[model samples]
Target: MKRWDAILTIDKLAAELIAENNYKGKIYATGSPAFDKFRDIDVAKERKRLRKKFGLSENVFVVFYAGAATPAGWQEDEITFKFLAEAMRKLQKKHPEAVFIAHQHPRDEKLGRYQKLAPDLKYFDISKFLPAGRQGKIDDTLLPMMDTVVGMYATNLIHACYLRISGVSILLPNAGGKRLFENLSLDDFPTKGRKNFSHLPKKPPPSRRPMRLKKN
Candidate 1:
């Protein structure tokens, strides 16, 4: 194993896998990435466009969410909703124009469950509104309008950090899970996951660009 080559790992299962191979490499654990991969998208433009198409004001804070939906690890699972509701309520209180836009887990069968919790959020499970190859139609359409993006235990968080999208989130992986294991050697490989992690978002845009900031 290369002294600088690290195995970004997650969970006891991953640790065991690495240990079994005697792979002497640095390991980085991050909150989660099952639903990660969105921070890499430049959805702010699409969000703005969608808001205009839907008659949303430019001042509105558009919080975006995309990624895995389960604690047990399914393509689409029911993870958490309380934060979304709270976010919506808070945004409404601070800026009534704030809106939450999200998508289903793409692999999920039950859309009703999500709708039941926050029917107002724009949910797209497998669209390009996030980051990836397909780059859905809505994604291009929705990116510009988003003042910010948001989610929990999502790869979208990573994407947000990637695209420099600013926002907030919660429900990260366990303390010792992916979050801790994924950045063991950030000093040597500083930008390693900085792009994606920066995408996780914050309540307000940071003082510095997500990418320009040091690894967390």
Candidate 2:
């Protein structure tokens, strides 16, 4: 920790932690440079443009599932996928304008498993639209186009929060799930609305429905 002349962090809390650890380096909480593109642009205009480029109408309600790499014994992924699939199915039936799309983690090899599990859900590969140099940074372009972002514990949720887009975190009934929420303090972050987090049961309830989005 002492080797570097300076350290940069995404937020003040992280900068404080580095300073408290007896680090001698200078600290800067300049937020993530990955989000620098979000600073000056007009969000409403950009969102419209991006949605059009992606073939989504302004009236369409888009829900984005941000998939994460899940190792063995981490049951959150399976639970979330099933829950979202069911909920989205119900939502789309009632609101034909609602659309569900997903992006899998580059390292998640079980992509086919989930796709088979939720055959109704559509997957979008943002890399196809991005230039090779920017392919790795899909969140910058993909997230703004979503009306809501859903995930188990992906950092993309934080990006959604910064963009003031609705973010939903599915909590599993296990210690791993508890620890992740405690470490991230996701509940502490302000969201677009109150119904951002969803607590799932061992089996998804047929009566349970996802939050409804108001059209722009």
Candidate 3:
């Protein structure tokens, strides 16, 4: 491994995975290339197009959720999805104009859950809205349009930070979990294997305001 060229990691999780595998190499955590790829996009135009495609208003508060790509047997992820959908339903009463959009894990393996869950909730799915091969564009566009993002641990959070979108991690509770809340950081993630929901924000937190990256 040392003889190979430099190892580039997209984010901290990738670096951690490599380290856990005991690969001692020159790993550069250079961030997501996807971020750089679509950084210069005309966001307003993309926002308009997406809203039109989803039948949503331009000024609606958009909450986007990112799902995982796992087997249908992954019960934990399914539970989390249900919990989030219910929470969003409760939130919609407060902001009727708010739109909830679900961005399935890009691999397409976990898209079925959305088909089953989105209709009753009246949420839109990014996979259904964007054409094939447009995942990068969707990320670049929707991350900026979203008011707050709810998802489990995923690289979407890194992109959210790149766009300064507020991301809330949904944690599974311990024991016979009845509720859950937004855990802002990795350290705040709850223990695995139970249902939970609580303390959700009606809008994006102040800390999530789009960042202005200054030159060093």
Q: TM-score for every candidate vs. truth?
A: 0.47, 0.63, 0.55
Candidate 1 lDDT by residue in tens digits, 24-111: 6766654345324444545656656666666668775666655345443432233445455665666667766566666555554454
Report the Cα lDDT for residue 205, model 1: 38
**1 or 3, greater by lDDT:** 3
The C-alpha lDDT values of all candidates are 0.51, 0.68, 0.62
Report the lDDT of model 2 for residue 127. 53
Tens-digit lDDT track of model 3 for 1-216: 435466887777677866665566677889755767555666567768767776778888898877763553246566778878788878887777777777666554644566586466766555556677776235545666777777766667767766666888765662112122222322233333212334344334568545799999
Off by over 4 Å in 1: 1-50, 70-79, 118-141, 172-216
Best by lDDT: 2
Angstrom error of the Cα, residue 157, model 2: value is 1.0
Candidate 2's error at 170, in angstroms? 1.3
Per-structure clash totals for the candidates: 55, 0, 5
Tens digit per residue, CA lDDT, model 2, 95-199: 877877666666666646566777775555555667778533455556788899988877778778778899998765453364354333333333432243335
Query: Candidate 2: which stretches are off by over 4 Å?
Result: 1-9, 12-30, 72-74, 121-137, 175-216
| Model with the higher TM-score, candidate 1 or 2 | 2
